[model samples]
Target: MLDKTSPSLPRGMRYENQLAMIEGMSLADIAREYPTPFYCYSQSAIEQKMQACLKAFEPTGAKVHFAVKANSNINLLRLMAKAGLGADIVSGGELTRACTAGIAPADVIFSGVAKTDNELEYAMHKGVGQYNVESIEELHRINTIAQRLGVVIDAVLRVNPEVDAGTHQHITTAKKGSKFGIAYSQLDSALQTAATLSSINVRGLAMHIGSQITSLEPYSQSIQRMLHWLEQLQAKGFAIDRIDLGGGLGVDYGNGEYLEYSDYAELIQASFANYQVDIQLELGRSLIAEAGILVSSVVSTKQSSPNNFVLLDAGMNDLLRPSLYQAHHPLLAASLSTSARPETFDVVGPICESTDCFHKNYPMLRPNTGDLMFFTVVGAYCSVLSSSYNSRTLIPELLVNGENVRVIRKAWTIDEQLKLEE
Candidate 1:
């Protein structure tokens, strides 16, 4: 029997008759219909999480935008749109995807550090609601694009407050010397320049400290700094009306520790109660990470001197967080009926690179060849980061709504990939 009390498992995932089940369907059944090494998302889980997030931030009158970089699948984006969430996009393709997903262009906020001139013009043409300007150069570029289009554009200056997010360094974005946002010291001059731009309306300030942030202290510190600048800009006669608190809220990935949305909402209310400006949020992982899992079939198991290895069909190309960020995802066997004893395994993928290992020295029930296994809390970055490296075909993704399942993305075949080549 699966341990129902274990926090590592995704919500709504449990065991029935010693078989792993998602929602009301058995994983073995799903794997039989759809191939293994595919991603499966629970519709009910995502909807519940979204509703909770919306409720938590409702008191702040915040406009929540789902960061499209997390999981750009159009089906999921459509679900977010249906839930009344806007799109926080960073590329023209993402903007198109959001629009195609039925999110209004007025609800899109284009955010990135290196948007090209063509991208700026395209966003303007598509009527993107706001632009989070990373540098004075980008601000000038927006002004130029707006001038060429003969339309005024709404924009906000993204400031780096030099606050430590206390998360992984690779995901930390807003500290000093980071290439993400404008330097705090240069905000004054940036605003002065924006004041001279006739086609651009710099309405507010934006700041994103980092991703997977567990502590509220960093957010508190970053908000304090942003408010300081907001007050300074207002004092200087700038009509500052918005504060984009770019999202870095973390979710629990088997650690049983994460930032609560209620606490974050309380902090926002307490901090901005005196101010009358609009609040905007760009949330990504926290909303969807715990709603999906990657189900893979065990290919083989072997002992190599000091380490026991269990190989699966999925690789770093399919889920790169382990190799790229050293992220940990709880692995569980589909069936707990194995006669072999539980063992410590270095779960690995069939990739050519040495960095394709998922977990090291992990304790789990011994899985036999052809048995099903899954990695939890992978809904956000797993599918979006997949690559067709080493001639491996991209896997399919399925969304489950109770007993009904739908393939949201079709698997890429080797023939299709070869067709693109000579």
Candidate 2:
């Protein structure tokens, strides 16, 4: 189905102000047909986001490698591949999923700190675009695998420039002491081994500072430092053909003003203009977050101590951001009424864990039990990270295209879950 007008998501669906289409169908209608807890996607929103990203980075000669870990649903992957995007993978599973999605093996680039020998061997057999080596040991591993496979492997040294991305500490990587990439002090030994290892061709550099990075200064600093390193490599007669910057572009959960695609691309392009090298970027959250939202029904509500609790049918088992990162997702009542007085409610889920709360200071207009709720900005990490904890059935995923909607992932059946039980 093709979307005509832009989508206007219900509040808490993401960046509150964007127009929400609900796929030209009502959220209540979708819930009634599919069941209480399910996932809904906006075809137009995803396409628009990709368009914006392409427009922003087109001037920089950059290729967008959709981070497969962000959302590995095969249907979503197929849509992205059709859009001419490449894949940025970190594991054998992601690489397999990308290939299953019809992404060319040569278009895939692997990035991670600890790739096992088997993962490297699998990637080499697939003739993946490059192996982003994080340490000298990894380089040796790649060479070892390539030698056994009788194929040359291309590699990019993932360097730690020590730039702070000002995001959450758990996700922060490129910091000097972080366990992500090689320290600057180890580069000489790495390059020395790389030059001698005929099985591995070290052709590029890669860096991923952190996740949810909304600032430009950190990126600019990282790019400048990387370029200087590349220049040094060129001075040493090592052929460096590209720079793969791992993507951590943050989506506007509340503040779209903080993340602007144009400004971010402009900062990177201006700095890299001196060099005529190919560039690739791997992005996940920023591309898919707004296009998807979770629909859940408020099962009941009660007064607890000094606060009102709105219990939802979905929980951290369905969406783990709250439990994992202490992340706050916006929540909105689908059947909103202007006349009803708004109230502050702690939006929670049925999971037994006390930490299974979506938002503690959640704002709500008057809402009743059985009212549908929308959890915005969940397109990236939500569904892919869901679990069967408490034996909860997996949420059904629906694809909405204009007035046409179809179920891509049917809700998990009890029998299906039991099939795996011993």
Candidate 3:
């Protein structure tokens, strides 16, 4: 049995979602069948967001390269691929899965700080679309690998503009001192070295200052830096063809800041109108953030002096962003979502680790035992970041398209977790 409250959904989301109500079924029914502590994604929402992104960015002739680090569920990947979105891969495993999902090798872009030689060889052999070259040493390594394989590798220099995107310190990756991209000073020499290498074709420039960035200032700074560097590269007699603007769009995860897809696209579209270079946007969070929800049940509620904790079945194992970055996700009693007198309570999960907490000292209306909780804006990093700590079985995943639903990834059993150990 469960209590009834309005679902804590995003601004335009439906409680009895069109996807949820199709064929007279609901999210709760799926949860009942699959049990608690699972992930449910809306395929319709994904398609809707993708369409929005495309419509918003086309003016600039930009191509969307969906970042695989978001939610790489194979079915979801296939859906995105079929939607004509290019892929941005970071690992050999991701590259392999991108192919398995039917993404064309030429439509995949590989980017990571520490790509192994074997991984690079595998990607190059598979003919990945572009390699986001991170460091000068990486450029040398790729050239060596390409030379050995009797092939030519196309690559873009990932330059660090050292712009500070006021996001979590862990996510602001474009700083001068960060390990992500080449420093400004070292970029030109890097291009020279690549141009001199017969096995490597220098195609473009790329940079992403940081993640969960809500403001436009940091992006503008990064873009301005890129444009200046781009001019410098062009002036030096280098033929750079593409501009890879890395992904860093933020979402309204109770951060009190919500960005519109149309506006973001319009801004970029305007910027691109002035530049004729081939452009790419490796979008991840912005495309999928509003498309899914995490459904967890309140098994127990505790009230101590000056503190309250709602013990949820979902933990950091289910959604690690909260514990990982001290991030917040919108939460409320799924049954009592419309209650006006919501109380503030710490939301914690069942993982044995004390860091498994979801929200601490957050205000919520008085929610009780057996009440379902809906964690909003979990569409991006939730399932993909899940872990099997404490030997917990992987949770089942349900994909919903309209009122239609399919159990994409099934919940784990204790036996399944121990099968390998035994």
Candidate 4:
């Protein structure tokens, strides 16, 4: 039946009358309204995920912060704000976006390895809730900035537990030499250094192992290590009132199993049952990835020896995950014929580089020129990482709420791109 949903499709998506639909709106219909290579998100899907995450972590009294680095569209941020999620930003611009989207500064947690002075000053002026201090030098810098601003800034020491998250190496942050948090062995020294900083109040600890972590072992190990230190620090007379267990919850991107929110929350509650501190989680891809899809049109088809290439209008400049991290996203045809035979095709983009390919030897229903396609599970790191490479114009983004759709971001035209140049 046309109303039946497919198990292969992500949440908020289904195949209706052989056409892929998002929140009841067909991809083909939306493609006609907006140009191809645009991103479309389901407002309900995101809200539902947020609700599930909140429910899962509610037992631990965890404050969920949406990682601003993932899908930072103002409308999406506003939706996150409306859902009672705080912003975990890595830069000043994201802080501005969060605030502009109606998130209060007091709810923002500023986190990044190399926060510039200007960004720190701006965050301080805006009264960000906390800063995740990465290094002792950064701690001193924050102290100097706080002293200059005549304010005592609340901060958390991000400790590197040296746990392997088993995610992509490029995304892992907590390994021994990963240049993320301070090494676990150096925690005492970092705490000592923080003790000397008159203007910085080290109220808690933080650790972000990596992104897209599916296994529970890594989180278990890391949290155990952090809790051990938390106990030691308290024994040493430090008042740690919070624990920022940075987000690395993974989402299924055509890969196998991912960590369930309930399992994750149960782990957190079990680990911290005896502690009386505020727990914070900064979730990014987990909450948004499944809610979004990138729509593109097949530009042309090429036949080469042992390979059928489906060239698409969407390039790596639009969605870099495949090229950048060899990431895999489910590629589907917007409309498929009932009797269509599956074909193996190397899906590629029109970019000049050879790395512009999306998938190789991917089996899907045969696509023709002008056929609409979708790169599913791209809500998190896709559009935010897009660049105007090869002079390609930036694509637009649309938010779908049932039958209602609105353009959240307008396409960046060549004229607008040229205005920044001399």
Candidate 5:
């Protein structure tokens, strides 16, 4: 049973009978305008989620950086920038996008384990705010680049707290044996090394345990560890003025409950009060995941022995989370009569791979060919991970505000793909 009260359900979204409506516009009407196999994002819903996150972290004066990898749609980036949000980017292209989208360079934090020399040079030239250095080699690279550029580069040493975030193994970052951050045993040496570099300014430290994290325990533990490190660094006469608690806040994905913003804020405020340093949060999925969904139409239906299947035009190439992480997204009919019967279906996509399925034996109002379905909680990683595999045209993305709908990205044509080769 779907819980209507779940925080994962964005504002202005409701069910008029069996038809899903966003801000009073029926999904069928949206499909008629935009066609099937497209992504529709609710502008008001995105704003609501962003406001909730800001409100939760308000007491601490922490700046929230919308993680760019989640969904770096230029339009969405502009919306977030307009809301006074910063950007947490992992690549040079993302940095360009963030700046072009109106996020000031000072508001951008570059994070990733393997930042190349060219990327680091580009970031320094752009006057990027801070570099979350993952390894000693990277630290040296920053120092060398800054020396050549004749400017001091601000940076933070990313530490591995070894806290088991208890989330998906693929997303876990800080646990022992993970190749993400500076090892705890080598932090002192790294700080010593940083102090010796004339072009490097060790502003503070950063850490990201994992993504899709639903519990606050790991976050609290990681924060405590960071604070302890801050104290030690301060005692050692290192002027640490900032602490970036990396983002991994999770949203309910129909698999489990999420830690409410109030509770999460309380936990963060309690641990962060001991220090006077500026705080930064790198939030990705939680702020945007529930704000959008994939709307696809049923191409056909079939039965294989004891199981039934419903095929859609959207495939793993459209949204890779299910094929990559075995993730779950609640499926619902876009429109149905009150007399529609409920049946279990293995909803799948048009991809050729065997892992192209979205839902397996999930009960829903039985849909016929040409009927529409909504894959919930796909705002973050869906379109961002889409591809042109199997020679399929890239899907379009639409933004809805109140009853008005507009296209953010148009469907790429086969000719557009061919033009690249031409």
Candidate 6:
């Protein structure tokens, strides 16, 4: 089952003679020990990516807060916390995870458009750092909850700057028609109303244009917009202390290419050069996406009409980005013959639906039954979005540090999952 280095692999992911190693350990060995249809992450890769991000934003004095929704595994959170990164959470569960992972409550920022009253109450009780208030009603709700708890809650109004982040339409949050943040047109009235809230400390401003953004122009525009509003609010006697530029830096899913953190930091520092405010970044994907891979075993290969199909044991239940967002995650055979020729494959999952397909007419090394296939750049949304669709139990998550591999999240059995309601 050994293979040679093929041109199909990404830069970081390569075949060392006959073994596919991520960081230092053999991916095939990990897959065999943990079984197929599992997610594996590289500790060094995640740390390197995180450090790069922090270094980039150091000039602007921006605090790095890892978005919990991206990869909420407590172990990953613990790693992030140990690296001096905070948490940007959207739910009570995520908030609890952040706390349990040893992240300080003062380092947690609660963010969500439709946060429930219970969630607000819990956030206030936990004394989370900031609430990215999305709507006027939500603002009032947080204020009321904080007042009930007899504590002052710090918050930032998430304004919808209506700028197109030039990303996927579904992920575009700050667009004119998006339901994410408060309308920019009514920001003035919203701020006035917010300032009147007794238990709410309107500390600053926040804006997230969109996700998977490659260019820095949208961010520059969004920052300028927020700064202009900040100046306007300050002129009206409001003291803004922070500006949270929500994180959505995209990764190179197709290839090993991405805007360097240094370059991104330069852009951010240049944009905020004349201003001084506590800058906060909530980066999620860019820091973790490329650090992980999904390894699945090919169940069978069949010749379909006008195409060859390679079916995997891992389906949409394991990784949903392909079906959900038509995302492109690079795929390669874990073992490849030096003389094997490249062939176009319709790589698909075991799901019964047509959307379960991972790639269509994609060219890669030919795969055979029981052969391992490594899906790259899936460290972010893949595992978090997994489910028990078709009653397939959730898979395990392995963390690789040097030559060590630890199962961070154990795979669930169907019976164990059924025990939930029992």
Query: Which portions of model 6 miss their true places by more than 4 Å?
Result: 1-12
User: What C-alpha lDDT, on a 0 to 100 scale, does residue 80 get in candidate 5?
Assistant: 95
Per-residue accuracy of model 5 over 98-146 as CA lDDT, tens digit each: 9999999999999999998899899989999999999888888899999
Local distance difference test values of all predictions, in order: 0.91, 0.83, 0.81, 0.92, 0.88, 0.85
lDDT of 1 at 398: 97
Per-prediction tally of clashes: 0, 8, 15, 0, 0, 0
lDDT of 3 by residue, 1-422 (tens): 01124234553345454233312346567666767777777776788778878887877788898999988889999989989999998999999888999999999999999999999999989999899999989999999999999999789999899988999998899876899999989988999899789999999899988778888878778888888888888898888889999898887776557556666666676666666699888988887877777888888889887989989988888889888998788775545355467677788988888898888888877766766677877878788998877777777787877556788887777887777678
lDDT of 6 by residue, 1-422 (tens): 01125444543466777778876777778876888899998898888777777777887799999999999999999999999999999999999999999999999999998899999888888889899999888888888888888999889999998888888887889888688999988888878898799988888889888778888878878878888898888899888888899998877776544556677788778877877688898989888888888999999988978999999999988999988888998887777577778889899999889999999999877777888888988889889999988988799999988888999999998999889979
> Which 10-residue window in model 5 sums to the lowest lDDT?
1-10
User: How far is 77's C-alpha from truth in model 1 (Å)?
Assistant: 0.4
Candidate 2's displacement at residue 175, Å, is: 1.1
lDDT of 2 at 43: 80
TM-score for each of the candidates: 0.98, 0.94, 0.93, 0.98, 0.97, 0.96
Model 5: how far residue 174 lies from native, Å: 1.0
In model 2, which runs have C-alpha deviations exceeding 4 angstroms? 1-21
Candidate 4 error regions (>4 Å): 1-5
- Per-residue lDDT tens digits for candidate 2, residues 249-315, read 8776754424677888888788888897888899998888878888898898988889999999998
TM-score-wise, the better of 4 and 6 is: 4
Residue 104 displacement (Å), model 4: 1.0
